[model samples]
Target: MTHSLDPAALDQLFLQARTFNKFTAEPVGDDLLRQLYDLYKWGPTSMNTQPGRVVFVRTEEGKQKLKPALMPNNVDKTMAAPVVAIVALDTAFYEHMPTQFPANPAARDLFASNAGLSTDTATRNSSLQGAYLIMAARALGLAAGPMSGFNPTMVNEAFFPDGRWKANFLINLGWGDPSGNRPRGPRLAFEDGVVLA
Candidate 1:
C-alpha cells in the first residue's frame, strides 16, 4: 500500500483552525489528547531538553478547580471548551539532560547550578513547545484557543503545590463552531513586522 495526501489539505487545515472562541458540546477524549501531545512533542527544542508538561482539565471538577486560576474574562470560555490544557514547565528539566543531551553535559550543569537560570530556560523553551502544540492540533484537524489571561499564581497553587512546575499558558481545544469565533483580527504586513538584517 502507498501513502497519499493532498498538499492543499494542509492549507485548508491551517485556515480552518482559527482561534476558536466557541466549542461544541462534544468532548475531547484522553486518547485524542495523547495523540496531540505525541505529535507536538516532536517539535524542536534546545538540546532536546523537553521541559513542557501538559495537564488536561476535562472533567467538570477539573474545570471547576481551574476557575479560580483563570482571569474573569477567561472563566466562561475555558469552562465551555471540551478540553482545557494547562501548559507548564518543569524547573528541573536540566536534570534529564544526561539522556536528552548526552553529548553536552556542560549544558546541563549551566542550568542545574543556577535556580533562576533554570526556571528562565524552562519557561522559555516550554512556551515554544506550547506554540508547537497549537500548530500540531491544527494539523490534526482540531481547533485551539491559547490564552495568557490567567492568574499564574493561582494556577501554580492549584496545580503544582510542590513547586515543581510553572504555569506558562492555558489552551482550550475542541471543535470550534464559527458562531463562537469573532472576525479574524488584522495582522502586520511582512514588511512591517520583519527585519531582514
Candidate 2:
C-alpha cells in the first residue's frame, strides 16, 4: 500500500521551499548532480518522452559563457551560485521514443509527421521535467532558483550551437542563504486559478 508523504516532506518539497537568490559557498559536486537527474527522470511525461536536457554550469568559464545571455537582474546571483543548470528541450525527442516508449513504436511516426505536435510535446514535457528537477533538488536538501530572464537566442548560441536542443530556462542550484531571500510572496487561492469540471 502506498502512503502519502509526511507534512515535513511536503513542506520541504513545496510549502516551505523558496526560490533562493543567494546561496552559501558550498560547492555542488558532480555526484550530486548525477543523483539529482536520477531522481527527477522518473517523473511521468506524455509517452514517456523525456525531452529535458541539462547543462550544469559550474566552472567560472561556464558562468562567463552564460553571462551575456542573462538579464541584468539575474546575472550577479547566477554567477555567485555554485551551479547553474541550463534546462533545455531536444527538438528531435521523438527519435528516442522507439526506445523509451517501445510499447507503441508508432508514436514516433505520429510525432515526426507533424512538426507542430512535436514542438508542443517537447516544450510541455520538458518544462514539466524542469519542475521535477527543482523538486528533486529540494528533496535532496538543496535549494533551487529557476529563472527565465535570459535571452534564449544567446543561450542557444553559447550552449547549444549544434541546434538540436533549445533553451527553456535556467535553475541555479545550491545551499540557500536565508539572509538574502526576500519575504515570501503570496500565492493564488485554489479557486482563483483552478477550474473543476
lDDT scores in order: 0.87, 0.96
lDDT (10s digit) by residue, model 2, range 1-197? 39999999999998999999999999999999999999999999999989899999999999999999999999999999999999999999999999999999799999999999999999999999999999999999999999999999999999999999999999999999988899999999999999999
Model 1: ten consecutive residues of lowest lDDT: 8-17
Task: Please estimate how well model 1 matches the true structure, expressed as its whole-model Cα lDDT.
Answer: 0.87
Pairs that collide in candidate 1 are none
Q: How far out, in Å, is residue 26 in model 2?
A: 0.4
lDDT winner: 2
| Candidate 1 residue lDDT tens string, 1-197 | 39654666657556445798888988887899989988999998888888999999898998998998788888899999999989999988998898888888698898888988787778878999999999888887778899999999999998899999888999999987778788888888999999999
Give the TM-score of each candidate. Answer: 0.92, 0.98
